[model samples]
Target: MKLYQRLHPGVNLGPTDPENHEEAEEKIFGFWIFLMSDLVLFSVLFATYAAMSIQGVALGPSPKDIFDLSPVFLETMVLLASSFTFGLAILELKYRKNQGRLALWLTLTGLLGALFVGLELNDYRILLTEHGAAPQTSGFLSAYYLLTGTHALHVSVAIIWLIVLAVQLATLGPVGPVKLRLMRLALFWHMLDIIWIGIFTFVYLYGVVL
Candidate 1:
């Protein structure tokens, strides 16, 4: 047995039907391509945010004026925890094959994700209503909303997807198709965590410091 397979015995599921394995590999490869495209999209948004951050804040609230670090920090931790729970869910699905435990982890992950989105929207409300940092106010605020809003949108969709997958798991158990879908969801959820880290560092940290 391979080292990883030995370490996590049930995960590898060695010597599957050849045709099914090929199809699964193809779908995963396609998902990787989609993720690469998403990376490009985020790269453009980050560059725009950087360029605009300095240009139009003189007449309005700066990032420092509107960013509440406490909430942002809390949401970041929440998202990180969700990712960890999702990892546990995968372990349960692959190793233990325990339906109830997997569903519990998935539910917890979805709740954490929803909380992150809620906190983010609250941040937006504070900026727009209290500090007058609406997208129409300045380039900085516009770019800020666009970047963060796009990420928030992604998380919202992910939460919906999680719900659907949980339903599937409950109905179908850990069959091949469900397992494949869960693998894709895992990649996606973890990807959002990474993107959030970048946002916290680049937008929030740099915005406050510089």
Candidate 2:
């Protein structure tokens, strides 16, 4: 048996080192499979949004009126930075063997995510009160609510997850279940950042520019 194999207390039905290169490769492939399924779900939502957008509301503000690229730009930057921080957290956990630093970085990740959501909510409030562009006001509003709200819901969930993991890291430290959970969380955070990039590009930027 390999040294890692001998050291692992759990049954070697699979991998011991969760981030072991070979195991990580297999896991990433599996995650991509699951992500494909998720993509299908998002595709359906996009199609729905597209269909609804065609039935445009006559009186309400369109994307041109409601969206400001500047806030979105900042939100995107925060998430992108958080993704990089998560990568650093993982690298630290794997290479440097630093638990306090790992948790600190993860906490920062959570804060960044919270900041993004806060900005989103703030934007929505401003749009609704200041501009009278609530979701009920337009078909464009409907689609905007559906798409951005979906992503916001996702962000909320991720934040909750980060909080839970923060607790876990505090009590359990970075091994076994904690380690696996953190690794999965890292993947999730990265995925959110990438998805936000698409949202900003396709939904916000293109929506604005075009």
Candidate 3:
């Protein structure tokens, strides 16, 4: 089969034909293992937040007092939209092979990611200033900052990666290595999206509702 025919979103493009490129398969598998390790790290962070948040308010503001659902909702929408745009970029590269179109989609993805980070920082500022809540204020606040700040750090890295990838795509024009790197980056980006969903549900929605 042709390369484009075999390529699909979220599908591994690394040498499936074991006889020809066994090394490529190994690399892809190793990258997956790395992602799994990251999952564990995020899982731990989530558990810590859940545990520490219950009674760690410690005379400080509660989640309901500090978390504004409006900005949280907006941040969630922005990140989700970035993920969608990234999927579009992948489709463009896999099907259309239009470098310009792919660049446009990737740029949109980066912009949305930046917006999410900006909103998150603004939220943090509000928590610190308006509510007098900082990481040092209480255990709950510390956990909250650690969890959300870690996720924000990942988002920041992703935005930087997107910029670098865009430059590579512009210069190299989606060659084999470029395509493989893009696929790996896509996996990482999608993983962040999934992690954010956990954060939104467990941290934001739960905080507001419960």
Query: lDDT winner among the candidates?
Result: 1
Using TM-score as the measure, the top candidate is: 1
Candidate 1 lDDT over 153-194, as tens digits, reads: 999999999999888888887888888788788888999999
Residues 1-210, candidate 2, lDDT per residue (tens digit)? 654454322312134354454454455557667767766766776777666654675688666677799998999998888888888887777667677798788888889889999999998899888998888887778777888888888889988988998888788776656665667667767777777787788778766776
Better of 1 and 3 by lDDT: 1
Which one wins by lDDT: 2 or 3? 3
Report the CA-based lDDT of candidate 3 relative to the real structure. 0.82
Give me the overall lDDT of model 2.
0.74
Question: What TM-score goes with each of the models?
Answer: 0.90, 0.83, 0.89
Query: Candidate 3, clashing residue pairs?
Result: none
TM-score of 1: 0.90
* TM-score-best of 1 and 3: 1
Error of 1 at 69 (Å): 1.4
Candidates by TM-score, descending order: 1, 3, 2
